[model samples]
Target: MTIEKTETINITSPLDIETVEKLHAGDRVLLSGVIYVARDAAHKRLVHALDQGEELPFDPKGQTLYYMGPSPAPPGRKIGSVGPTTSTRMDSYTPRLLAAGVRAMIGKGSRSAEVRESIKEYKAVYFVATGGAGALLHRTIKNVEPVAYEDLGAEAVLRLLVEDFPLIVANDIYGGDVFEQGRAEYRRGGN
Candidate 1:
């Protein structure tokens, strides 16, 4: 199949509804600013805290969450080998977080139908980072600090200050899903 040229879009975190609304599936993005890092363990805790009527470690409103875990920093660097995890593992908790006002998420794969619906209903977006490119991904992280669930070690939720973090829109607020589209195109012989 031939690849279409997609313009790279530059965006910042703490994204607003207006910004998310403008994004579409298949568009490439360079995300800058703050993003919270969380994995399955951290996701569970965040949802549990919400269930107990407690505030999250960081405000979800207008913010982006990256489903990643970082290896221990090597020497002077602040982080090492940060990469996106499989998004499906976090699907069950995603709708709740989206409902709580998270504007976007960065991960590596397709989402569940329910999560896709929630993305539309909540005006949020899902982005896919390149899998198996942890070393390259780490270059964009300008700062990293522990945020919550310290005992989880690498799985702990941390705050990341990123510049030009690479991603592609996997699902958009308008019900667009790039994975589905790509599959359909392939089946149709890329016509």
Candidate 2:
């Protein structure tokens, strides 16, 4: 489904810090605000930044990071078809990111054990977008600008203003995981 991008939304729902810590698997959300963009390369750079005691390019506290590497947009488009990439590749850097104050991650697949535990410990959430549904996601994005790390190709960081973009919680701080639930619902030759 496509939703036309309209007014820029400001997500002011302080997201009850306690409730945010309990976001559950299969829950849907309308992210009416800003989020940071990061990918495999940017994750590496961030860890190194931590090692050097440098401030992250953006604040992680109460912030969400979308794990993606987008295709260049064609003329007249705010951004190319953008969607979350597989997330397991980010496992190594996630604990560190969580420690640095990140409260959520948006991506396509399930997180590793270490990442999931960190979410539990840090009061964080993991949201999921439709896999392979880039064209549809693009309709929700109205503009694009980078905050940092511009030399890493599409892996460079960028900020996007999105409106009512659809997503489902894949993992939450409460130890629930959607992938497991989905798998349990379906089995070999079974629906």
Candidate 3:
């Protein structure tokens, strides 16, 4: 499919259902604004808190979660080598988060069938941050502060303020899956 010059979109965080519904798999996005960071350990804690009906550090509604575990900041930097983790690791907890009002997620790799269903059901979207591009990605991050699960170290939940954070829509509310389409195209030797 040929993309038009206006296909790329620039968006800010705390995306609502209407904005997420407008996105489609394979669309390029330049996202700015606040996003929450969490990985395996942090997800576990959040899910546990939800199960126990405890208050979470941040509201999930209209929020975006980046599946990442960043390395410690060196000296004067706001962060270190921050990159996306394999999204599948968080699959078990994703539906709960989506149900709790998380509207978007950033990570690498394909997600489970259940998660995709939840995305459609919740009118949410999933985005892919390029893997192995930590250094470049870090440059887009303007600030970072730990928000919860501090004892988890690199796995702690963090609030990040980013400007023009790059991403590709991997899954969209309309049920598009870029990973599947890309694989099919490659199998047919179609660029």
How many residue pairs in model 1 have overlapping backbones? 0
- TM-score of each prediction: 0.94, 0.89, 0.94
Over 12-78, each residue of candidate 1 has an lDDT whose tens digit, in order, gives: 9999887898899999888999999999999999999999999999999988999998889999999
TM for candidate 2 is 0.89
CA lDDT of every candidate? 0.92, 0.81, 0.92
- Candidate 2, residues 1-191, lDDT tens digits: the string is 54333422223222446657545787767775677789999999999999999998877787788899889978977688888999999999999998888877889888889898998898888888887988888887877898888889899888777777787888877799999998988867734
Ranking 2 against 3 by lDDT, winner = 3
Query: In model 1, where do residues sit more than 4 Å from their true spots?
Result: 1-6, 188-191
Candidate 2 wrong stretches, greater than 4 Å: 2-16, 188-191
Per-residue alpha-carbon lDDT of candidate 3 for residues 1-191, written as tens digits (9 for 90 to 100): 13343767989999976788789999999899999999999999999999999988999999999999988899999899887999999999999999998999999999999999999999999999989889888888999988998889989999999998888999998899999999887785434
Separate clash counts for every candidate: 0, 0, 0
Candidate 3: misplaced stretches above 4 Å? 1-7, 189-191
